[model samples]
Target: MTASDEEMPKLLGDCVHCGFCLPTCPTYVLWGEEMDSPRGRIHLMQQHAEGEPLSLPMVQHFDRCLGCMACVTACPSGVQYDRLIETTRAQVELEHPRTPAERAMREAVFKLFPYPRRLRALRGPLRAYQKSCLDKLIRRTGLLDRLSPTLAAMERLAPPLGRTPRLPERVAARGERRATVGMLTGCVQGEFFPGVNAATARVLAMEGCDVVIPKGQGCCGALSLHSGREEEARAFARRTIVAFEAVDVIVVNSAGCGSAMKEYVRLLADEPTWAGRAEALSVKTRDLAEYVAELGPRAERKPLPVTVAYHDACHLSHAQGIRSQPRALLAGIPELTVREIADPDICCGSAGTYNIFQPEAAAELGDRKAANVRATDAELLVAANPGCSMQIAGALGRQGVDIAVAHTAEVLDASLRGLGRGSLVQRPQ
Candidate 1:
């Protein structure tokens, strides 16, 4: 092994061939394929560490993984599948040569999704397409599916275009300022679901936080890091670290960004120059629910009487161990009944860019998750991550389920302002 990958063997050895992760693994749960399971993937990683060639089939298994870190949560052995998979992916990108078609598709996704400006530029055209009802006509005909499944998944997963409001650089606390914090306006979250970021800022300010939003901040490299583009992820991490270095605490609304940002220490471990900064930033980074739960509620929550199913975003619940905070926050709203989805641990198949990359498997998982949500019979579905919201929304749309999906902050923001349920809950079109 090269010096860069010297840790793989030790990480690989941590797995004891346990079957514990199988039930929680989305791919394994879907297919029951041994290689698709976490233990099975670790077995492949072990073979690779011992000098076996990185074969295409083996790489496919890794790529099929959702990287939800549910396995990390399931493992009693405390195996670091998160680190192992990430390391293997970086190696895959370096050593393996993908077919031209797959490479081009991945290249397009990496190019468009990671750049905030590019995504923002898309808003105008996308809004026009949606407004003109052309998207509806095109989707109705299903031409995109025949053209490209990936593109079709993109179309299916696109959130309804709404008013894109500009967030202020700072939002002062409403009453007594308990703390000053910086917020991460993520690429997808900022461009597609601007409402979540707006609500995040408003909720934080209401909770007695002076929210600071640094200008020109883009992706935190969560997409790159999770997908195994190490250098690209590092560059984004560095930019983010520099952008929010002065803030006492960093708050993230999207679960994927929050989880990835919290792992900056490992992402930058090879670079001595950035190691300390990365660690410091990771230490301070918190999910909105996590931070808010820690800060406790200062603003009085007006009644938002509605039954809602809380879809646990894997990154928030499994990766960040934030299962209760969101539930608590939702529960705090008097008369708001929180119903639980059937398989709380299973992912909704929106692991960063996993839904786009592995559309077929993601679709199956999304379908399964949607069925469970349907069983809840709640008036609305609530999730923290935008990707989950979009994925679930798309699945529900496909299944003709009309339950609306809202972010936790959006719900809390509505309650704090004494707004009606219609203000926050929105059905994806």
Candidate 2:
């Protein structure tokens, strides 16, 4: 469908020319270009609404946006920029045709990133490459980015791979059952960082919950949905709803997946067959930190003296309005100090595949973030999104900072089990 076929939603008018979003937007802070800010994009949407043709330049302006939703959070008018951007992107995907190179790169990303089996196949070779010092040699020589910028960026962002344990279909509650939730072990979370999901299950079970690791679960349609491949995202959403089936709640460890799943109702709005089911799934979905906090401290938390800086994933902080929940959960840990990084509202440029798509900008934003983290002088960094952890870890590595990074769940698991360190995965030596 083209712009002529549908009118732009009235939500676009809510901007009120508010400059409040200017400072909050990542791209605006970096480039200071009017075409890249939220207000500027809304103006372009207005032009399209008024029958101005969608030009390639307009698409570039939209493409430059990180989609971090910082403007939405900063706006007092409560403008729904998130919905506007998604709608515009769906139009872009349908109406615009990219050059062969750009198209192929996007296709490769969608094909590979959303599937677990393909990524699972890559774990062995990637681990060997890192362990054997090949990765170090390549980074030292500067041959990687020259070979293929995409591969080089991906390699740098790749997490430390280990023998991922298989998750059971059902993990029984340890003490007394408080609530039953079907866990969405995300594609990347399942294949690349399975330990986080395993830790999640253990912590959930310890907190008096029957954690069901439903089989046949796949991507929660976050990548597709965020990128405006509406039909594909909808299909993934329905599969998740079908897989979970009547659970008390749907718990997610990944922030991006949880944000997309929570919007299942809106994503499936056009489908009569699955719309109600999508609503049900959306209502029951909760972030791991959210659910864990509600369940309260059921198990023993052992002391581990570590100063941890909590990096807010954009989706979790801006999209989901979750700031204090994870911090509250972390504070429950004995002797664990929570330090706030400078410019907490800014993104580390890992807005889904933004780091992969716009590597240069991602690197700059990443370096800025890593520098702020370094100044914190903390021993550990905690982030909810795997993409953030991957991006931030790579940035810190490049800065020659050796501070370890871990998911919020892994930290909780370490405290609950009385384990001493090594729970949080660190960069390759």
Candidate 3:
């Protein structure tokens, strides 16, 4: 049975009410509300399991959870808070009703974010807006603050849009073919950060891997899955599985997308036909850093010669247990000083759509994370996940910090190609 089905109660029972999860939980740390913590949320889940109704208050607590899964990493008893919270969130999406405004806002987000074409269409307008001085005018006039916080958060989190270069269907390995891999050009990652995808393909090819990028691939259903839109997420997952069925191993760049793609086995467990296929795809799925690290770096690394603060995206760190691989990759480069950020375990508040939905709390958390990143005094910020990159960049921008944020793939790609440090690090204008 899936975690959302009969196994949910057992999963909930695993949490031992140990307070070890408290300090690591972003929401609990911010609010100090017991219900906001993992153990407290599990208590609420237990209450519902014991025949109590899933009340609005219970739903609110569940919504507050960033699903960062730091608690999953912290728990000594190996409590599966990740599965438990996902199941609970699914229940809330099904049983609870939000206000019309909330529903509309959520509807708008889902409609646009998951579809690659929709996001791609916005590239021209978004790029033009960034260049038109209107973006600066709105922010300078404090008009964003007067608008809805969600809109304000969206505006603030918009990365500097650039040319969206389309990737070819296949990139042959530069040398002897070591491995053939399929790449997931994620929805947001592809549209917002196309350079990262481009660099990923180049780096893979340089490392003697034939990169197969299926044109039909879209969202990995990460945003949907995280937000409890189970059916929508499954549909996306099913399509993704079929698109890359020919490839032996699937590689993902975005952390949240990677985590969700890896969870396809559980996400599609109830589906009779798709369950086995889901498991097959899940087994094949690997994060870009995780896959490259496992493949063993074959490409030459030139010196970057700069201090970089590596921000561990929650899904990468806790959901995927990919802490060292990225750092190890960076360490491979000569003269690359990897500075550790304070409170590395805490979420940057860009928990998928959490930053957009809970702007107030998200802003508070973002500011806190920004402060921690500043303390490192790193020249550049390197992150594996695009969301965390954007979140941290926006937060730093708010603080008048000009540090540039680059994906792990981008930095590695630069070093592999013998590009200058100026190629990777762009000081804000």
Candidate 4:
């Protein structure tokens, strides 16, 4: 159903214009304009709802937003910026015509991300292109010369592709345990960073919880929803809820997927049949770091001598409000030194497909983030989100920096199992 002109006003009315969100908003600082900030966007929604024409400039301001949801964390007014922005963008897509190329790209992303088979099929080509020197040749020839800067920035963010790690159907607890959690094998994470899944399983097992990586479960549809494929996202969410129904908890290592899974209630809100079930499923979902941290003393520990820097994934810190849990878990390792990267809350510009879609802007943000990470001089970079790990790892790799980038759980699990240095230094193949 289309959003009515009336509904916009009701949504806008919720924003009290407290201005607590300004400092956390990236676009507001970039443009230094009130209209670009969350409060400003809410005002624009109000105007558009009340029959005011949305000018091209107004729409451009809205498009410039990274949708990192940093404002949502800072809003004392409980503005629900994510809901407002998503609904507004949906309205924009329906009412305002997009260019043919833009529409095609959006359609392509929707078709690619929500389907696991297609994503797996593309991996071979992606790996071949990267390894064949063809990627370098494209850069050297300046074929896509205009996109070089953006591509260069993204290239720096790519992680080395290694063997994909698949978790067992069911890993019984080592001694005795009553808890079992179904792992949400995310689309990109499953294909790209399987080591993370392996580490998550090992860590969960150490905590005496049986880890279940159910087959047939697919992407959480975070990317699809972020890219405006709401129907596809909803379908995937329903499928995921069904697949994990028997498990006590649904564990997600990727912050982006965790954030999306937690919001399954909102995604299926309109569906009477699925709404309650989605909410129930969402309640059981937990980020890997959060879950391990909650398991308390069960997390095993050994000294890890590496100095590690933590980069907060936008979805984890802002979207999920999960800032401290990961850090506390990391600190539990006696040998691990946890250092903080400056501007930790800023987006690394790997907002799902944002790096691919808005490459230029994404490059600037990624570079800024990479620089901040470099300044820390930490031997290991730990992040909870797969996207952040890939983005930051790619950036560091491009600069000839050899510091290992890994998920927080991977690092912590190593410490617990007395495999700290070996697990981290040995590249997963």
Candidate 5:
């Protein structure tokens, strides 16, 4: 769907400068710059729409934003900062001509991140290095730090790649077939954290849903859409839509991917041919937690007997309005003590490659989030997104705080299968 280009200003006009979004905005909290805040960025958008050219100075503020959507949740006037930011980001990508180096970096990122095969290819080399102690040698000698901050941040953010589980084309429900749903084996989730996908299929099947993992299914355009590659995002969204047309629902384990797919109606609104199809796909998309929670926990949750602090992925909690579902799922586990960390609304600095681009600020936020998680004194930290898991786990590890970070689905899968506590921990670090 094509968004109203002129309505960009109208959306900006809806912001009430009451300072309600200030505290919730990550960049504003970091620099105290008015332009870095939600209203301030809206003002910039207003100016650009009027007649002023988009400048590097103006774009830097937009670039620093984590896009965590905390401001959208905090806004008293109910301003749609989420859509506004996305619109402005699309404008930036369209109007702004980045330098050769910056363009190359963006090209490198989009080229690698959205392709599972490319990521899989890198895993073999990375695994060998890690096993050969080259990773330790580089880190101990500070050789990794010698690389560009961005590359170093990417290095640190790398989750230990486990053996990728071969996903089945379909898994029939056990006993009774309640529903047949398509599962999105997303780029990073499929390649880097296949265990989560495997566990999700098991839990869903055990809960009486036949799960379908369509082969040749690619990225759902979450990462691309978030980064303002609008055309690239649309291409991927189209492919995803076609692949899962037969399913009753599309279950997404990743928070960002689900949120992006949910917005496909708006994303494709401009394409008359695909708009209706996109809308149909949007209505059927569900986060893994949302689907499982509403399904009423088909498999009995066994006693966990461990303390777990649940970290809210901004996209899940703030963007998708899925705050209670994941927590409720966790609470349903017998003998599981659920603990809430301080400043639960804050981003863990893992806003969909935000850490890769703005590593310094991302690191600071990650450290802050790690500290809060540490204060919870929980035995395991549960996060809903892969990026959050990697960012928080890396941050905690840097501080010498060793704790397990598990996906919510992984934890639930363990409980359903009656696995012990050790079987459930899937730390990104």
Candidate 6:
């Protein structure tokens, strides 16, 4: 069937119009409109499915959505909003073409992120921009005011780039281990926050799992696919499946990548040849925290006298429905007080490219999130997904707060090895 024919009914029929999802929806809360809520979106889809025309206003509401999937978790009717929103986005890209500048920016992301070689090549310029204070100076001077709102938004979300970490060819288990696992070093995370990957490797080794950093595993195609570049994302997905074919289990540290990898069967559904293989590989995929937690007896625990506030990454808590695993793992550590952030399930405005693509709304959400994090009065923030970690870290940094941000695996790893309590903290250079 054609794309349009396939998406209409799926998006229309998924929602039962239960108002249970309203309070959990960020956009719905911000707009206070049913049309902006999950159920409303489903209704819009139904209208379109019934041969009704989509108005420009209707499209605007859909575009404003962060697509965080909180509604999916909150829905009692089991609405498949993930599939609906994605299909809606694909429809938007096809039926409602973007302006030239917007199209150019989307093209740039697909060109740079999915291709490992291109991303590696661009690292030099990105690093230089960060180190020279050009990035900061532009924001400080409000130079972006001259650009379009979209470009300004993109500029604000660009983190201060750091040197990419070169992954070791292989890291063997410290003592006897039963199995080996390969890690998918993500595109942005590998380039900006290599230390997280390093920490993940160390933690896995501590748990008696040999860590393999397979070369040539490119971006997981999440950003591309989410932004409507399906064919390109599918190509990268195929490449990733081939690259890590030999590993016993593929561990992903980023919740976004983990969720995308877990959905590889659907992502590659059109490719009959690789559909089953993708499903098998996706089955073996585990979030780093989930993997570490499963190696339960091997995960050593020690007293950590710090208060840690855990922020749930959207992908982990909502998309993957992995709300309890990370918290349970954190609680396993002795002397570490695990406090929950108010609205822990709320999106931190870092919905992959959402921050860059929709800065005004993203910043508003970020500010609110930063306030919530501060209210916790915790010195350390723990999160599983790299995007959430970076976004929250950047937001905290911008507010001049001194709290340290880290992945859940990083904290667990430190506790397991009985290392310094502050080891998980991301120190400013």
Candidate 4 residue 129 C-alpha distance from true site, Å: 2.2
Off by over 4 Å in 5: 1-3, 425-429
- Judge candidate 3 at residue 406 and give its lDDT: 91
TM-scores, all candidates, are 0.97, 0.96, 0.97, 0.92, 0.97, 0.93
Instruction: Give the lowest summed-lDDT range of ten residues in model 4.
Output: 149-158
lDDT of 1 by residue, 327-374 (tens): 999999998999999988999988888988899999999999999999
Which candidate model has the greater TM-score, 2 or 3? Answer: 3
> Which pairs of residues have clashing backbones in candidate 5?
1-268, 1-269, 1-270, 2-269, 2-270
lDDT of 4 by residue, 74-122 (tens): 8877777787777777767767777787777667766776677887787
lDDT of 5: 0.88
Residues 9-63 of candidate 6 have per-residue lDDT tens digits of 7546767776898888887777689898888887887777677766777777777
Clashes of each: 0, 0, 0, 7, 5, 0
Point out the worst 10-residue segment of candidate 5 by lDDT: 1-10
Deviation in Å, model 2, residue 127 alpha carbon: 2.3
Q: What would the per-residue lDDT of candidate 5 be over residues 279-335, giving only the tens digit for each residue?
A: 999999999999988887677788888899999999999989998998889998898
lDDT of each: 0.90, 0.88, 0.90, 0.78, 0.88, 0.79
Clashes of 6: 0
- Candidate 5 global TM-score: 0.97
Once model 5 is optimally superposed onto the true structure by TM-score, how far is the C-alpha of residue 235 displaced, in angstroms?
0.3
lDDT of 4: 0.78
lDDT tens digits, residues 1-429, model 2?
112234455676677987899999998999999988999999998897778888999998988888899998999999888988888888889888888988998999999889998888888898899889888899889898887787788888888787889989999999889888899999888988888999999999999999998887888899998887888898888899899876879899999999999898888777799889888888999999998887788899998678899999999999899999999989989888999999999999988998987888899899999999999998899999999988998999898889898899989999999886655534342
Screening candidate 4 with a backbone cut-off below 3 angstroms (N, C-alpha, C), the clashing residue pairs are 156-394, 156-395, 157-394, 157-395, 158-394, 303-335, 304-335
User: What would you estimate as the lDDT of candidate 1?
Assistant: 0.90
List residue ranges in candidate 4 displaced over 4 A: 1-7, 16-18, 53-55, 145-158, 397-400, 425-429
